[model samples]
Target: MHSTPWSSAHRLDPADQHLRDFLAPRHSPAGDGVELDVDTLLSQKYNGVVELRVQVAAFSFQNSPSSQNAPRLLLDSSTPLNGVLEALSGDATYAGCGRCSAELSTDANGIYSPCYPCLPLTGVRRYYRPGVLTVSGRGYSQLCVLAPPVPLQKILKAPPDKLHRSSAPGSQVKLIQVAAERLHALLSLPKKTFVITIRSHFLCDENSAPLSQDFTLLDLQLPTDCK
Candidate 1:
């Protein structure tokens, strides 16, 4: 028989009341929508490789109320990895209160010039102003373990004009449950690359519809020797 995705131990209890409570009412967040396919998401536990795609030019937390720049990057490779690296060589304004740095590596690209160490989760937390992400990383390399269920206050405070009209009524109720369910799914996997997509929006004009933007969860794969 075909083995279950990941493993039986990693399987989520579909009947759990807590899960039911979280998944029962679900709705998409307002922003440049994010799509993830569970089957298409490869886990290194059995596959022995990890691949990721991030929108580099289109991903980053919104900096100003009217700023429309979105930076996103996508990285994918079948090679076993000891670390996750990014080309900080691209054009972008870099600013953060936390300590950060970069390096150059020699590859076919000729010294693959400038690689920026991932920012610390704490810095990311402060930069975002709100929202919590578990911290796991050494120096500049960090792993995003879990993002607790989205809070009700967050949903309510999200620029009202930018929220999905259909989701505004029940966004909080939907997010709390959805966050919990996602937490369960995350806890089930140990050695893997997971992506958490977050969408942020702001009201541009009184009559203008809410504008949503997206930021990707970069490589959350921690340095591991496990299979």
Candidate 2:
């Protein structure tokens, strides 16, 4: 027998199994729905309209979005997440207002060794910020990495110009969908590595507190290195 790159020697772990189920391909033999095969993609020379099965997310709202039941969602691994972020129900992504201890900087090597910074903090609201992520070790480093970031936004407003080019791992990043029941787990983050991103207009009641933490949902994800 021959072993290929996808041979049984490598398979998704239980934690990763859901990711495969979350992002569906354009074409599948399982359903009668339209499918886009390699032949079609090649026929267009890789440029044309394409369809994808989205992971529609809806929150069971009862009170405030800032409460433990905040609005949030996770997409594929974190690789091409930004490109498809808007496609996930056309929701808006809010920026973080949290302040790092001090001014931070990055290097051409794509490693952040000085002070840390926060994520995409771009929203109409003020005085409020997104969640906080800290790494612990004998000595650690923090870099606000953007997956193929929003181009100019990711570079200009980003940690640095080289940031948008930093994420060089495989195209798969573990996305965490914090279920209300397991919200507490967010505190530990198990491995202590993840991305706490958000979506806009994730309202649960008639009233909206754009500045309130309620508008933010917890994104308890694994770092971009999970099989």
Candidate 3:
């Protein structure tokens, strides 16, 4: 397993039989591979108090960042509506990407501060089609999908803003923050698979080949018919 800056962070649900079956072998396929993803569903509210539930998966990706994009993890949610809107409106935070480096604020006792500083993704763009969400960043590119909520045929789509070069190694991904009022509706949408494409600035190995590829597909089982 790759080492991360954090010594102890939350691991994926071990109870997930399917994820265990897939990750049992710590090997990255030179090309492609797929496993029956069986992991617990994640639901949490953000600062806007928007509720988000997404399936979580851990996979050995080719171009994934080494320690720079620490926390060494990625997340996917069936939140095209939530995701795109957040992106356009600029309300999402990039989690598990870079470590925060902020000054510590201490109490009267002079105890170290609890809050940590974090780095956010810079120079990224996100757009929504009826069915798909497209993201482009300095060295990263991504596509997000929310299913059944709206049939692909009924959905009109548009391209994401073009990304300009950045000092980072991969194209940056967009983080969407949602409104509290929209949280319940986001959670209420019919469950579907959420797919995210990660393009890392790092190469697969020593070859210097790009490390951007599709990671795991998380299935969020939402209830209700997508209009």
Candidate 4:
């Protein structure tokens, strides 16, 4: 006896078990589902709103600044803790490898091993969080999800205090050291395997990106939080 492939999705978000069951056939390549995908909706009306139920696979807090090439800080367990706080405490932008950015760990004789390559991979940036997800019934995976400050704060379960970095880690950092704290909170939350309704948009030239759907999350709830 073998468990079904769709069963995993049901277990991932039991609250959406019915939804998965209803949309499973349409989701699969077999194509029994009369799903209204982004293209269908867009064709019907440009910049159309397509309702979708998706699983939030990863949570990334991006430090996307006005600089077209600002390094994005993908806050995860691997992100250096002290380095995060230090950068938030001072600089508006930090550019350095993880080894140099993190607090030094020295042996009894003051000797320490260096992180080879010394790559500037892990960064502490200032700005947006894309809780990217994949739809349950649908045309693509990894939907480019966006959200307004209020909805984001609710989903991330962040405090409404001035500490929350809804968008930019503004110049107000000198008085409010909230960026690091907020990052800490987001990293601590249950950021995986959830569902939400999304609004679809298109590029100004009158088309949506072919590879990824432009989405604005209407709302989201983590599986654990629902329990």
lDDT of each: 0.29, 0.28, 0.29, 0.45
How far out, in Å, is residue 189 in model 4? 12
Off by over 4 Å in 1: 1-129, 132-175, 195-227
Alpha-carbon RMSD of each model: 24.0, 23.2, 21.3, 21.7
Give the top-scoring candidate (TM-score): 4
lDDT of 4: 0.45
lDDT of 2 by residue, 33-132 (tens): 2333323322332322322211112111122133446544333223242333232213222222334322223369854443223445322211111222
Compose the digit string of candidate 1's lDDT tens values, residues 1-227: 87767644566799989879988966434223334332232111111122332211111122222244654332123211111112111222222334331222345965333334553332311122122333222223232222211231232222212222333465554322332233223223342343334332233346544343222232232223211
TM-score of 4: 0.39
Evaluation by lDDT, superior candidate among 1 and 4: 4
User: Which residue pairs show backbone clashes in model 4?
Assistant: none
Question: What TM-score would each prediction reach against the true structure?
Answer: 0.18, 0.17, 0.19, 0.39
* Candidate numbers sorted by TM-score from highest down: 4, 3, 1, 2
* Model 4 C-alpha lDDT per residue in residues 1-227, reported as the tens digit of each score: 98767544323565587767876754432122223544455455335444544443334433433343765434444555555465444322222234444322346886543445564444322222333323333444345566644455565343333333434455543323444544444344344344455566555543644444476666654455342
Error of 4 at 147 (Å): 2.4
lDDT of 1 at 88: 16
Q: What's the CA error at residue 77 for candidate 3, in Å?
A: 9.6
| lDDT for 91 (candidate 3) | 16
The TM-score between candidate 3 and the true structure equals: 0.19
lDDT of 3 by residue, 111-212 (tens): 544443332332222322212223222223222333221222122111223222232457354222222113324333342333222221222446635444
